[model samples]
Target: MNEFTMNDLMVLMPYAPIIIVAVTSLLAMIAITIQRSHFVTATISVVGLNVGLFTLIGQITGVIDSGAVVASAEQLFVVDSFAKFNMVVIFICALACCTLAYAYLANLKDNKDELYLLLLLSTTGALLMVSAQHMAAFFMSLELLSIPLYGLLSYTYMRNRSLESGLKYLVLSATASATILMGMAFIYAQVGSLAFKPISLVLGSMFESPLLILGAALMLFGIAFKLSAAPFHMWTPDVYEGAPAPIATYLASVSKVAMMALAVRFLIDSALLALPSVQMLLVVMATLSILAGNLLAVRQTSLKRLLGYSSIAHMGYVLIVIVSIGAAADSISSMYMAIYAFTSIGAFGVVTLMSSPYRQSGEADDLSHYQGLFWRRPIITAVMTIMMLSLAGIPLTAGFITKLFAILAAVQGTNWFLAAMIILGSAIGLFYYLRVMLTLFKRPKQFIEFDVAGQWGIRVGGLMVIGVTVVIIYFGVLPNSLIVWSDMARIW
Candidate 1:
């Protein structure tokens, strides 16, 4: 009995980082009880996340290769390779955001400490979402992630636009949450079990019933809403435009990744998603999102809004490989997701650096703000160009490699039509992405001296991300190490 307990402990060892973060969050909250310092809280959070990231790396090889890690805290969570990978990604985003926020929020007044607390708690929620194995755990984690976002979006409490954005998100998210609960109730009624693996066993047999189909559809709707896919993405532009740049970056990068990771886990693990109708639904959604997102982005005048639409389109590309799921294609989606996460972070990091805390009311919008950026911040301008090019699927960047994988997976699925649309969409996307790049080089009406402050941390982060972009492109050209790694990690 003692041997069995020790073995279980070994399997569950990798998730200690998550536990540490949660504890550290509580400690920060307690610190607030005595005194309030947002920078100090952010410092503590960054340190914790950095330590956690190192610990996670230490455990990845052994745990992922030959063993599984599952941590149960009152049976609400279970961490394994998939969850751990996502948690690491989330932690990296969190660390960068904290650094950015330290600079971005230094000027803001009111509830700054509370903002840091909310951010940490929300991250914990996202971590829980990735690890949830049952319906109750799923619903709780989803709420934990969303509820904090409502506040985070409106952190600039006195601003009317920010308040409006918060209200819009709160209402829509509440409706979506209700829809998810109804679907889950139906699922429970049909399967008599709320656990994922168990429900998956009987999902196919239950699909003939309308209740099951409706439940699955509703559930997809809710999750899709979370992902900011088109048609359900009305809230994104407003939220992104109203929120501060750092918060916008968080939503654009880490928040979306966590939800996508959860979606991947569900579709792959839950056998019900294999039903023809479900698969077709997903494929159609991906197709429409790719087409519409690029087209809509072409008309956006605001930088944040354009990126919001661009993000939706990127999610569509990720969905292409996701819909083509099979043992032969798993690595395609994972690698694509990794590159997407990195590029999004880099892009948003640039945005945060460019934005002024005391800028215009709608600072999140108006691409004109980037006018003459090249003359002011040459290095970041170059980095942003690389990021935009990568996002547009240009050669010699991470985005290009990821898009190649998606296209390959789509071709293997025999969806030549999807391949064609992806090609066409990439063409349309290039115009908008390049339009911004052109702005960077454009000669402004007056030689404006933008008073942008320099932070070495951001510069270092941006350069590191650009270096990664170079490697991503290099791998595309060589097609050796990345392919081998993907091949090794591939699982149905």
Candidate 2:
């Protein structure tokens, strides 16, 4: 039994971020019950996230330097430099999403307070997952992260597209969950243990066992679905298109980043990547994701849908880092994911600020919505352009730097095919991204029903987007700092 000890409480010191957010959710719920004020509830979430982020940063100095593995007595959770580094991004992005949600939820007719509750809960789960060391923790954290998203996606339940997207995600996500559960069961049947390290030890000898292979394969399929790689990615564009912009941003940045971090830790710790069956499954998924994401995004006019598809491609790119198993894979994965988070948030923040879930006119997500946008809002237009350019992996942008890292990792691992795919996908991405930029500068539409207030540029959501864009540009131009930080983050 994983009995509690006084030492256990001290061991949990490193988990302040997860604890703070989890506690905040409960407090926010209580405060809402006392008096339903969206502002108050949101304020609590924002303040709590900020506190947690500060706590995380405060520990960064000692945590990153030592690369210490702080685990619960029972090993349900474990925090290391890798977890610390990824948690920084997760916490910051959750803060950004909270800000965006605050702005987005203001005009909703329905109760808005609960959305913050769900967001906080999901964020707590994401934080927990980055450090999870046990099978129970992994599944619990995943569900905690996912279940709240169902409600958040349908928060604007009045819209037809919103409702449809919610149902689709619910059913599809459940199927993936089942698949993952079965895989876990299979692995447990053979190994008689659910802890990651123990499973790795067992699988090392029985790697050829049918039970182990089937278990690893089933788990990989479920993970691929979560990553939205290739054939399993059909749900991405619809989910992104259906969910509110902020919710979509959370999906693309926070949860996806956490999942990738977990995947990296799992592969390394469990040694599943040693199996040819696992490697082949991932290689095929990575290749298909690159091809499908880039090709499909070209024909899409909706910026949100395009991003949804593009995100799939980006994950595929990250998958290359995972499969490469190079010495620099961790460094590369961290840098790529950090840049991806900044760029994705900036991009979706633009959509969120431009469109309103509350408005009957629906989101300003259509390509036509931005025609001649530069003439009216060049600053905002500039932000969008930068996001698109970065995502296209244009030179001197963070996206370019991250994509370069992924390619370098592939080459280092001797994965020439994956390296080629990275190059090809980036090439294909330019076509549609350029299409988007051109639309921004086109003749202004006569029916200008811009959603936000005139002074919105300096507001919370606007500031968040601008801030993220600035980080993207800074990291892109001078990536040494980012690279050095990433290099410090390794799974011990």
Candidate 3:
């Protein structure tokens, strides 16, 4: 066996963000034990996340200057342009979530310091996931990302809905995990190795085997559940409705984005995209998700639930690009994800800020709650309107650009069916998105009191909304830079 030495440690220097986040979680736990000050814990968590993000940026620069770097751990972890790009997006989303959570959680009666700890852990898990190259690492990192979400989802245990949402997600997510594990076991049995390269080598011979096909389908099912695609997306609206606005935003944006990135990596590296049956299955899922998500959202009154369905549809659009993996797929998918992240965060941030902390009743999530929002809060209403428009894929918005990119990719790949599905979905999506926008501008029948406890949090959240709004508009208008960046992010 090779001797373990200090030099081996040097190889992990590029993974400083993951290491920093893990260490920060430990520190937060200890700090919480000593003095359970939410502010102190929040500060520590924010600082740690910023440090980790900066470290990741530095690592990326170093790599660009001196080629890609593989971790010392036998290539189980990789530090490449693709990993780095997705990590940056994940980190930004995590940071925004942290900032939003600080304000949102401060008014809660319970001890909220541990929420930051869970965020750190979950972020660390996301970082690990993007870098993971082997099956063991992938599953471990997936759990690391998921386990913390269970706690975060139910952080407001005082709410019955939160508890119910947590339980539902836990059960479904566990079932998916078990399915994935079974699939991985089946693949390993046939290939005798769990690494991507070796598995690809054997995939040709194993392609005709029923066992391999079943295994691949199961694996796809598990990933689809995480993506909240149709046929496995029943959990989405309930969870989004029950979870706090910030947590819902994280789920819709950060968590889904990371999972998609990993899926892209796995499919490309393992050459699993070569399977005809798999492609057909994905096409079906994408088509159904697009139709089901939009049709369901059209009838929803709850803004959170509506956005949940909207996410499902948006993810369906992304899947179209994923299925059409080609020269432009990476750029299109990345741009689409980035735009979605910005819009989702902005939309949810508005919901989060509008909520009343002292009320023991429902969140400010109903469509009626936003009536005459333009009269009450024009800036916020404008931001929300822009977000909704983006989601609807309207022109002069990031969503439109991204959707166009997806269509272009589908056409380039000769997936005319998927291209048509996207157009139909976008047209259907416009109705609900417009409904929300109209509600924002409608005159209220009665004046409703808007109460928020954390002024500082409101300011921070507002700033985040403005920031994301600016980005959405900027990219929607001039998307060249983002397009170039996404093009640079090659999976293999």
Candidate 4:
């Protein structure tokens, strides 16, 4: 064979969607030089994202099932079907974010050309995190995903709560990053290499080593922080409550998807999920998250805060899928994740559209604001109701089918006890979900009418929610298309 050299890294060059996003950010900045209009920047960002998404489709189309695209043991990243699937999800999320941002920013005054650029760069980071194979890429992508969000969280400068949320995120995220780095240091000391496969190989032989356990524990803590699983999830409610509704939606949906994909990649590939100790730890976390999230959400009056807790619970269910199934059942996990993503985006998008900058923008969290929603915007209220029902896992909604897969997978992978608990949790969640729906129908004491029309963009986004809700219900009724593709797209 020819001499091994760094030049071989060129084989991985086809993974250009990550770089495309970075380049798009630069192009968006140049839009400022040519025309500093928000519309111009938004248009450019949307077009660039469209192109990037198509490029990923072309790259993965025929080859995704053949196996890892670039299997080299580089100390940084890997390109595989698993990563490709996640890249697809990330790209879709980015496209949706741009669509919503384009529409929303057109009305807001403070959003300059640079906001689109920041969004693109942030997406690039999330993409990288999904494909990352080692500590360096992991840390780099994690921070990339976060730094722009800090600014984006505070984009609504006039809103003091937005600024406060950004600052809180910055501080808490920094601590999480530090914990990850320290954990990585321990791993490097134990294995002498940061490549995940190599570390796993070394760890397999020394399973009982204290150093190995310590490193794994630390890594677990870092991942838990990223996943926002209970105990490490203290910042979620505050951040969700304080951020712009759209941005909060992106964070809760897309960002979590990327992180969970990464977590799946690490656990499945590293053979770490099979460990009894690790499995036990995740079980406890999942149980706590499910109980805490549902119980807390029932008491919350603020929609965002309720959603924050709901997300925590949703993640708990997703984790149960991850830990219960090994590589043989990864497609089910991805399918569940996709359903969750669509439902979350739809639900949060409803929140964003319902709360207008002119009226409910800063006050989006107050549930009373939606008191007379049924009479004001019938289409939106119906769409929101569908999404809420789906989330609550009522029969015939997308959420039900997706959740069914998770519960089924958990049952197949373990004893009936786990399935029983998950079912119990889902049942409890329905109560709160119905409570919100009841409030929507509760007639205001007086005839209260709210303005529903602002611009076509808002309406269009609302339509998107309706469209997604229709698909969700369709899938729930007939889940074969998603189930087939999910089965075929095995991560391991």
Score each candidate by Cα lDDT. Answer: 0.74, 0.87, 0.83, 0.76
Tens-digit per-residue lDDT, 1-492, candidate 1: 999997876765655776777877898889889888876787788787787777777766654332354443335567765676667678877776777677667676666777777788888888787777677888888888889888888887667777787888899999989988898898788878777677678875766777777777888888888888866877888888788777887787678877887677666666666677777777787887888789999999988888888888887888777777543444576566666776776777777765655554655346676787788678778777888988898876767878888888889888888788789889999999999999888876374434346653355444554555566567657666766645533322
TM-score of 2: 0.96
**The 10-residue segment with the lowest total lDDT in model 4:** 62-71
> Stretches of candidate 2 above 4 Å error?
1-8, 63-74, 326-328
Selected candidate, larger TM-score, 1 vs 3: 3
lDDT of 3 by residue, 330-390 (tens): 5567668878987999999888887744455768888988888888577788899999988
Deviation of model 3 at 282, angstroms:
0.5
Q: Which stretches of candidate 1 lie over 4 Å from their true place?
A: 1-12, 63-76, 326-330, 445-451, 454-492
Candidate number achieving the greatest lDDT relative to the actual structure: 2
RMSD of 2: 2.5
Which is superior by lDDT, 2 or 3?
2
Q: Clash number for model 1?
A: 1
Best by TM-score: 2
Q: What is the lDDT of residue 318 in candidate 4?
A: 85
Per-residue lDDT for 125 in model 1? 81
lDDT per residue for candidate 4 within 407-446, as digits (tens), equals 8878888746567768988888988888778877878637
Clashes of 2: 0
